[model samples]
Target: MHCLLFLRIVSALEHRYKYFRFREDAVGKPGHTPIKKWTAAIRQLAYGGATDMFDEYLHIGKSTARECLQYFCEGIREIFGEWYLWKPNPVDCHQLIDMHGSVHGFPGMLGSIDCMYWEWKNCSDAWKGMYTTGFKGKHPTMILEAVADY
Candidate 1:
């Protein structure tokens, strides 16, 4: 994790939500939950670290750590979704096509270059057969057929 970026996220969250403030508890005791700890918990979860490991290293409860991760991701999307995540315009699409053609010498290939199987964790049993490729265990799966230009 980039220390400066992590600190920025913590500061932003602290400014937006008072919960990140280091304050005294009800019994007039200083709180131990640091904004850095919350930030680390979220980062660890994003990196697929075990919940128990977070409890051991960051001193955060498993459930609380998970909640922190969820809230952090939601907060990021709510704050930065518009500018960072957006559909490409027609001009952008044309640029991608031209770039791909120049790089690979493919004229008609717009976007159909890669394929990947993704786990459908919450897929219903009724539709499993329809979605499943019948190759990867018993659970249903979905394929991501993408052709990213960048």
Candidate 2:
């Protein structure tokens, strides 16, 4: 996810969802939860990464990390579903065709596929050379190509 979008989601969840807020324990002591930990959990799950792999860096337990993932998914659906999750209508299709034709001289254009970089953290040293590509950077990153119209 983009950094700004991720931050916006975190802020929205923190304010709108009571479950994401840090709580106070006995004697008014603040709970140990940090919003970053929760964000990390959700990002990993969204990116198809292993939950336990983040335990070392985020200093979060496995069970708590799983809980964070669940809450993050639920909160995202509740908060951002209206604007982001929708089916295209006839008007939308017409607008897309017109816009693409006017801008790029192509009518009836849907979209194009592009490459995305993903770091290889657990890649073996011997295979790192094979995975290495100069497209994005020096790191051994797997390129993700996807097609999107909007």
Candidate 3:
């Protein structure tokens, strides 16, 4: 996600859900930040990253990671579902086709393939030349080829 969008999500979720809010412990030690919990949740949801990975990087527990994921999904639905989840009407389709044609010279095209940078961590020597993301500043990056919401 873009930085602004990610921060917007973090801010919205934090305001809407108490679980995403930053808190202080009884000893007055600062607890996890909103970014930390949201990062753990988005990493798992978007990259399929392991929950244990956040334990070391984000200092979040496995159970908390799962909880974050659940609440993240819930918050997204509650916060953005109205504007983003509906199907496009015919007027919307016409506008999209017109816009795409003007931008890319492609008309009558509606479906879009969602592509994302995916780093290849354990690529073999022979396959190292194939994947290059540039997502983790790693050697290999793979473009995800999933058809999202189409």
Candidate 4:
């Protein structure tokens, strides 16, 4: 069961990545050699491989590998949007509310909220401030707040 779930997640991620690559390609972006090579490296990592292995397999230096991974992650973020995408039906409110109540032990908690910090590299200082918030230090990042409707 766990393996099945893991495979499903990987498949979804790959599909989303491919969609983003296709969209960019359609816009007449530069050659796709980098994206293609990085995609294969990511697949190797997903299946089980070290960063060094990826570097050797792709013939990329450490710094280049880092940049490529960052590009891929950013691409995924761009296509997925900065927030959760969910469709809420008016007829399903009651059921959603009941489920939330049961799970969260609150009448209207709906969903959950969380935050994460990602390292900022190759970004200007001025832009870093806009991305950082709360107690976190300066870092080029994005804030993603999501909630369920009940």
Give the best candidate by lDDT.
3
TM-score of each: 0.60, 0.65, 0.64, 0.31
- Report the C-alpha lDDT of model 2 over 1-150, residue by residue, as the tens digit: 687876777788889877678888689977645476566666676666667656677776667777778878787788888889787898988998888788877788867778878988787796577778875576688877787555
Which ranges in model 3 have alpha carbons more than 4 Å from their true place? 1-6, 24-30, 101-103, 114-141, 146-150
Candidate 1 TM-score to native: 0.60
Please give the CA lDDT of all the candidate structures.
Answer: 0.70, 0.74, 0.82, 0.54
Model 3, 1-100: lDDT tens digits are 6999988999999999999898998999988899999988889987676677677778899999999999999999999999999978999888887887
Model 4, 1-150: lDDT tens per residue? Answer: 376754444454556555324233456765335444455446544644334445545565555455556656665455444554456676566677787888767675545666556555676674566556644555565545456444
Question: Where does the lowest 10-residue lDDT sum fall in candidate 4?
Answer: 17-26
Runs of candidate 4 exceeding 4 Å displacement: 1-32, 44-50, 82-150
**For residue 144, what is the lDDT in candidate 4?**
50
Candidate 4, residue 51: lDDT: 46
Better of 3 and 4 by lDDT: 3
Which pairs clash in the backbone of model 3?
A: 131-140, 131-141, 132-141, 133-140, 133-141
lDDT of 3: 0.82
Tell me model 2's lDDT, rounded to 2 decimals: 0.74
